[model samples]
Target: MQSPTKPLAYSYIRMSTDIQLKGDSLRRQQQSSKAYADQNGLELAEAFKLEDIGVSAFKGANVSSGALGQFLALIKAGEIARGSYLLVESLDRISRQQVLDSIPVFFDIIKSGINVVTLADKHLYRAGETNFADIMYSVMVLGRAYEESKTKSMRVGAAWENKRKNAGTRKLTKVCPAWLSLQENRTGFDLIPERAEVVRQIFQLADTGNGSFSIARRLNQTAIPTFTKSNGWHESYVTKILNSRAVLGEFQPHRYDDHGDRVPYGEPVADYFPKIIEDDQFHRVQASRRRRLVEGAGRKGPEYRNLFTKIAKCEYCGAPMRFVHKGRPPKGSQALKCTNAVRGLGCESISWRYSDFETSFLYFVKEIDLTATLKAAAERSERATVEQQITVIEEKIRQLTAKRERIFELLTEPGSSTAFIKGKLDECEAAIATEGAQITKLREQRSMADMLPTISADELRSLIASVQDMSAPDIFERRAAVANRLSILVTSLRIAADGRRPKMKGIRTFLESQELNPDERDRLIDHIEKTNKQSQRYNRSFNVMLADGVSRYVVVKSDDPTDIIAEVLVDRDGAISGSDRGMPIGWSDGWDNVFDEPVSV
Candidate 1:
C-alpha cells in the first residue's frame, strides 16, 4: 500500500517581551516545532513562519490583527489548503487568553480542517475528531496560562506603585528634563551646563521686560537650539520655558487626559535638583506675567475681539480684518480694520465700523431668502439617497469582477478543456458586464439628483426666525453667537465703501459644502448612521463626526422621551436642508420637510 502523502504544515511562534525575543526562546520554539513536524511525517510549508514579538497573548492580541488573525483570514479566503497541520511550541504559545475567549478561536482554526500540533505535550488535535478528554485537557492548559498572566500583572502593578511612591527619593527616570542630566548612578538629576545656561538666558530676557515674541526672535537670531527636537525658538516655546518649575529645581509629575491636556498628578518636589533660576528671579517673572495679564497683553479677553477675525478679509490687499478697540474706556468704538492698513501698508480697502457693519449685517441676515438654500438642501438629500443605491451596485460589481478573475485563473490550469473553459469565462464576463451597466445607470441618476431643489414657504419662514435676534450686549458674546449662525446660514458678507451696505451672499455655499453622496459605503459611514442609536435617536444632544473631519453636535430637545427621536436639530437652526442626512427615502437634495415623520423623497 502507498504511504499517505505528508500533510502540509505551518509554524506559529510568539514572544511577549523584548527579552524573550532577544534570547533563544523563539529559536527553541522553532526548533521544537520543526523536529515534531519532521518526526510526524508533516512537511513544513514554504515561507510559513508567523511571529508576533512583544505582543501579549493573554490580551486577545491573536484574535485581532496579529499573525494568528492573518492565518485565519488566509483559511477563510481559501489561500491555505484544507487538512494542513498548524505546528506550535505549546497551547500557551497559541494564546494565553482565558478559556472562554481562546477556546472558541482554537475551535475556529480546527474547524477550518487544520490540525493543531502542540509539540511540548506531543498531542495532535483534529477539528471533527475531538473527544471530551481532549477538550478538557486543552481547557486545563489554557486556564493555567491565564492564571499565570494574571499573577504576573498583579506583581508588575504592585512594583510600579512602589516605584511611584519612592520617585523623588530615587534617581530621575529614563527621560530627564533637557536642562538636567541623569546622575552617574542613574538616580536623581544633575544640571547640564550648556542647557542650564539657555534656561538662565530665558529668565534674564523675561526679567529685562522682553515679551515672549521679542525673546523668541532674539534667540532665533543668535541660532539658539530649543529644548527637545525643535530646531528653532518659537513664542510659545519661550513662554513654556518661562512657566516651567524645572528651572527652580522642582520635580512635578504630570499625566495626560484623553484629549492630551496635561494634568498634575501629585504635589511637586521642591529642590529636586540643582536650581538653574533663582527663587527671587522666578517670583519676579511670575509677577511680570500677572501684571501683563492685567494690562491686556497676551491675555484671553472677556470675549473674542470680533465675530469675524480671519473670516473677514480686505477686498484690496486680502489681509485679515482684525477688531480693534480705540478711544477712551466706555467711549471706545469696535471696528474691523484691515491688518495691512493698520500696519502702514497701502491697502485701499475701507475699514468697516463694527456698529455700522453689525446693523447692516443683521438687517441682511433677517432678510435672508432661504429659497435657494432650501432648494440646494433638497437636491443634496436626493443625491444622498441615489448614492446609497450606487453603493450597493458597486459592491455587486466588485464580486462580479472577482468571479471573472477566478475564471481566468482556472483556464490556466492544466487539462482544462477549451469548450468548458470558454463557457465558464463567458458566464463570468456576462455577469460582470450586467453589473457594470447597472453601476453606470446608478451613477447617472446620482448626477441628476445633484441638482438644487426648493423647500416650502413655512420651512423657509422658520429658518428665518431662528437668526432674527443674533445680537449680544458683550462684543465677544455677540460675535460668537452671530458667527456661529452666519457660518451655517450665510456664506460670505461684503460692505463696499462705494455706498453699498454689507450684503450676505446666501447659504448656498454652506449647504453645498455639507452635502453627502452615499455612493461608497465605506465613505458614507463617516457621515451616515444606519441604526437609530448611531443616528442619536433621542432628545439628548450628541455629536457626529462628519466626512470633512468636523465633529458637529446634533442638538435634541431635553424634555422628550429618550426612546424616540422627535426632531434632529443641526447648526444654530435644525432645518432639514440646514444639515445633511443619509437616505431612507427618494433622492432629493434640499431641506427635508417634517410631516410628523421624516419621509425621504
Candidate 2:
C-alpha cells in the first residue's frame, strides 16, 4: 500500500570502522536507501543525508554523540518538516544499544513529527503514534541487535582462546619479541644478535645480584641503546624484561576487557618463542630477583635491609650511593661511594665519609625546637581549607571542560542541524563561563593563602628534635635508623659533593600539628614511610682503643655506614694506628677489597 503523495525522506547510514571503507559497504548502503526512496515515490532530502562511519552502535555512541544526536538537533530546530520520512538500511543500522536505551531514542524521533522507515522491512511508524505494535516491534528489533553484538563478542573471545591453544603447538606466524626475528622458513624465531646480547647482559647483571634500578643505571652509563625511542632503558622496562617468561622461551597469552585490564585467556606455552637466555641462567636470575626484591608484607631479602642503602643517591649521575669500608678489623676507614662511579662507569660523583656526614646531620638535628614547628604546622592546616576549596573548583572546571568537548563533538556531527547546534553551543558556552569564573575566584583565594608566614626557626628546631628522638638508641646499630626517620619527614635531602650537609625539602605539615611527644603515633607514621622506602641497613659499628696497656674505648667515625665493625688503636701521641703491630706499616685491607663479595644487610 503506497502513499499517493510521497513525503521527503532523510537517509541515515552507519558503519563501525573505517576499515569497512575498503569494501563497498558505504556504496551498498547508499544504493539501497536511494532505490527505496525511488520505489516508494518519496523525495530524498539531499542536505539531510547523515552517515556515521567508524562508530559503534553497541556502545550507544549512535544516540549519544553521533549522527543521531545531530538528527535530533535538526528536528528540534524544525529544519526537517513534519511528516518527513527517516530512512535507514535496517533497524539495527540505527542502533544496537540495549532495548531500554534504544527504544527511548526511537520514541523521541517519532515524537518529533517525523516518520521512521526501515527500507529492508518496509516498516513505517509515524510521529505521535502510540500503538503497542510499533513499540513491541521496535523493542524486538533493537533487542536482537544488542544480543547479536554480545554474541559476536563471545565468539571473538572463544576464537582468541582457540588461536592461543594453536599457538602452543605451532610457532607464531607474525609478531615476535624484540630480541627475536623469524627464521628463513618463517617457521621459528632466531636471535637478533645485538638485541639478543642486550638481553643476555640484562640476565647476566641480574644473575650477579644487581637489582633492576642498578641495571638500568649501568645500561645508561654504558651508552647502550634501547628497542624503543620513547622510554630508553627505564627501570620499569628492566623489571618487565626480568619478569617476563619470554626470556626462557615461553609465550604467555592474555585477553583484555573493555577497560584494558588483562585476563588469563590460556595456559602459557613453553618453547613457543626462541630462548634468549639459558634456562638455568634465567631461573638463577629469577632466584636472585626474588632474594633482592621485597613486596609489602611478603618475602624480603637481606640485600635491601639497610636504612640508607638506596636513599642516598649520587648527585652526579643520580645513581645510588653505597658505603665503602676501607681496611680490615682494628684499622677503621669508610666512605659513602657511588657504586657506578667506583666501577669507572663514567660517573664523576665523589664519595663522603660516614662520620663527617652523620656529625653534621646530628648537629643540625640538635638545634631544632619542636614547639614552634607545631604552631607553624597549625597555621598550615588553616591554609589547607582554602586549598581544599580551590581543588574542588578546579575539578569542577575539568569536568565542565570534558562535557563541553562532548557537546562540541555532537554539534559537529554530520547530521547536526544548524539550529540545534546553535542552542547546544550556547548552553555549553554559558556553563563553561560560569565554571571559569568559579575557578578564577578560587585561584585568587589560593594566592592569598600562599602569602602566609613561612616556617619559623623554632619550628625547624622542633622538627629536628622530633626526628632525633625517633632514632634508634643503638648508635652502633647497622641501621642508620635516625637518618631514615628524618628522611620520612622531608620530601628529599640533597647532599652536595664537597658540602656534605643535606638540604631538605617539603617538611611534612602534619608533624607540626601533632601533640608534643606524640610517641607511638609519630613512630607509626615513620614506620609506614620506612616500609614504603625500605633502605638497606649498613654496618655502623667501629672501635678504637687507646695504648699504654690500659684499653680505652673509642669510636672511630668514618663516612662509610656499612655494619662491619672496623677496630683501630690510638697511640699516646693521639695518632690513629692499625693493630698490625708485627706487619709492615702500610699492611692493611684496602677499600677495593670490601666489595669483592656481595654486601648483604
The number of the candidate with the highest lDDT is: 1
Worst 10 contiguous positions by lDDT, candidate 1: 498-507
lDDT (Cα, tens digit) per residue for candidate 2, span 1-601: 9857668888898887677889998888777778878998888877765977777787677667888778888899999789998988788888887788887888888998999988777788878899899888889989999899878866775666566667755554567788887767656787888988998899887765577888888999998999778456898999989877788787766644222345433345668887777755665565445545562122112222333544566654567777777853348666677778789897645666654554444333322223333334444455555544555455445545665565565443333457865676687678778867876876666432123344565554444344333242322121223433444443333334432122111123455466657776667656644432232112222221212331211122234322112223334554444322122223244433321232232
Q: What is the C-alpha RMSD of each candidate to the true structure, in Å?
A: 27.3, 24.2
User: Best TM-score goes to which candidate?
Assistant: 1
> Using Cα atoms with residue i matched to residue i, what is each candidate's TM-score against the true structure?
0.39, 0.38
Task: Give the TM-score comparing model 2 with the true structure, all chains together.
Answer: 0.38
Cα lDDT tens digits, model 1, 41-88, are 888875776877766687677658788889889998999888998888
Task: Give me candidate 1's TM-score against the actual structure.
Answer: 0.39
Q: After superposition, how far is residue 552 of candidate 1 from its true place, in Å?
A: 34
Instruction: Count backbone overlaps in model 2.
Output: 24
Go through the candidates in order and give each one's C-alpha lDDT. Answer: 0.60, 0.60
